[model samples]
Target: MSAVMISRKVRKWEKLPGKNTFCCDGRVMMARQKGVFYLTLFLIIGTCALFFGFECPYLAVHLSAAIPVFAAVLFLFVMAMLLRTSFSDPGVLPRALPEEATFIEMEIEAANGNVPSGQRPPPRIRNIEINNQIVKLKYCYTCKIFRPPRASHCSICDNCVDRFDHHCPWVGNCVGKRNYRYFYLFTLSLSLLTIYIFTFDIVHVVMRSVEDGFLSALKETPGTVLEVLVCFFTLWSVVGLTGFHTYLISLNQTTNEDIKGSWSGKNRVQNPYSHKNIFKNCCEVLCGPAYPSVLDRRGLMHEDSPVSASSAAPSSSSSSLSFSNNSKPAPPTTKTTAPLIPNEHTPDDAKASIGVSAEQSCSPEDLPPSFIPPLASPETDAEASVAKDNSH
Candidate 1:
């Protein structure tokens, strides 16, 4: 029976639409293909080499000697930060433990009505108190565990990341808790580098124009114009990203939270992590006081007793039951002994019979009274009886 049940479940899972096997290697490959990581890298190197080595020398003969060296140093720093952000772990959650099994068992028991009515667990979807404020934590079905507040599942990475910021295509990685600092640094450095290059190109053009005639300088240093345009276009995006991140850091909010409207209005005050002081918030994100490792079932950061969805079985069961009641009808039953029934049924007659059977089988106390339809009136019953007699 158990084997059959397992096989049935496996078949059901296999039949589920849009269910695809998540391969880490495949995900990485996809990210590489979609992201502008290589394209951006090439642009950085090619533009710098062309502008600093060739164009700068032609435009500013005297200052050309120092330009290459400065450009090289800045480019290297930007690359370093980019690489660091890409390779660093984004704080993946650990696998389920044996203790979690117990929690699951408890929830099952509660759902099955083994537990007392008064002791029934609270609903899982309801908010939990964390640091004297109510917070709603979400469960990740893919991970088979609850995610911490600010944590999210990245579709590209196919993993739940702690303090998830965003999946940055430029970096070719998810900008999450562990790597956000490096990602920010990379953006800031890239913006500065672009501005520096833009300034150099502008200086070269201006200086050349002053020394030579305007048309002569433009005609001779065509590469300077290209460099200036490239720098100007790239700088807009890079600087804008840096500025946005700076604002996020000051507010102590992630891109996901900002976009999803999670920390708006009343929720802003309830968020325990935010200090409301801009300086303090920025320090927390950039300087790093470090978030707590441990969390309760509620997903609150603490060193208290470990709790999971299974740990608070009653609540989980109640939530599950509530969901089931809302979404579906009661289970069908089969018995060897057959009950007598009329051969024909009108639409209303069939509905009334089914409702009567459901009410008889499921008690009013066990399920909501709404599930059971009211009995047929005496007039209707008399009509049904008279029709039956007439047919006989």
Candidate 2:
């Protein structure tokens, strides 16, 4: 008896094509990028201090120190979330080879008379119908498996991510199932921080301007003007991102799915994945389940669903059958029918039926018909034939 091996472990990122060496140096590169991100954060903080503290000393000294403290704390929280998002596993699917092998073994046993022939399993079916519409689960040829609904292959990361959001160039990672919460938190916190900074900078400018004339204050506090402008410009993008994510969380949809127009198709009003309760959706996204559940291709959540031969064998066969059916060409149509005009019709009647006048056949308008090639006259053909015979 052949032993069945099952790999419960999710596919590793480094094992993906063109990533063999990335595994060795990926951490180093990631660390470097993360350092760069941290440096950027510090630069923003330094800019805020330089403008707010040095340029507007009067406003800085008089204002409650607690404002800067609060902003610092918020910034740190955003940093933490950003780090989490960058490092967290993005819900990779397990490679199908092990499961596929087990299915093959079962089929072989049945064929060899080890199992009753009547009990032979149905072929594996990958495409399934949902809401009266046939929906094909996305199969990653690289991963060699059918990914769950809402999951997508990220070409950049070279991995299929579950509940795939979008790959953030800033974070230098794919924002997906395990890290989506962190990404959302980071966006929300960053938006709040920008808003706070913008407000604080505006207040500082106004307070200093009131003490001195507006032009003198502007000259004296150039840093404050810079900080205010920077924050004001950055505020809208951060706020918009936060708002968009908040809406997505409420609907239990991912950025990828929303952009792909997956939600509005047949499942528009009746999206099974969404709990339909905003509060529930938020809790599910933010807090997550106490026990992790495996999401099937249909997006159905299952806890401790044992992988038995009985269950696995049928799906494997079905998938193979589906592949075969899709690969095979459609049967040619055998039924031949007579033309609209019967062959027994006279040439004049045929011309009349075709709505073409004999006079128009040789007309200049029809001389250059795009589809028809020019034909040589009988005289030209006879001359060519006679010339060929004489040459012979």
**How many steric overlaps are in each model, in order?**
4, 7
- Candidate 1 TM-score over all chains jointly: 0.59
Q: Can you write out model 2's per-residue Cα lDDT over 1-392, one digit (the tens) per residue?
A: 22223334332333333221223323322222354556556656676566446533454469766776677688779778876766555565555567895675565446555445678554333566665555657556676666776788877666677878997766667777877888898889888877877777777667777888788877876777677777787789879999999999999888887887876876564566788799999999999953231322222222322234454576574554444346664579897644344354457657575545434444667665576756999999999999999999
Off by over 4 Å in 2: 1-43, 49-52, 55-60, 94-136, 266-269, 290-392
Local distance difference test scores for all models: 0.68, 0.65
Model 1: per-residue lDDT, tens digit, 1-392? 01110111122212222212212422222233334877778878877876766565654567656776777788999999987776555554543455885576466456665545678654444357767778777766565556777788887766677999998877677788877888999999999899988887777777778989788888887677778788889999999999999998988999998898776765455556788899999888999954432312122222222234344456565565445346664689877644434345447567678668766876667877568567999999999999999999
- List candidate 1 segments past 4 Å from native: 1-35, 55-61, 64-66, 95-128, 265-269, 289-392
| RMSD values, in order shown | 22.0, 24.5
In terms of lDDT, model 1 sits at 0.68
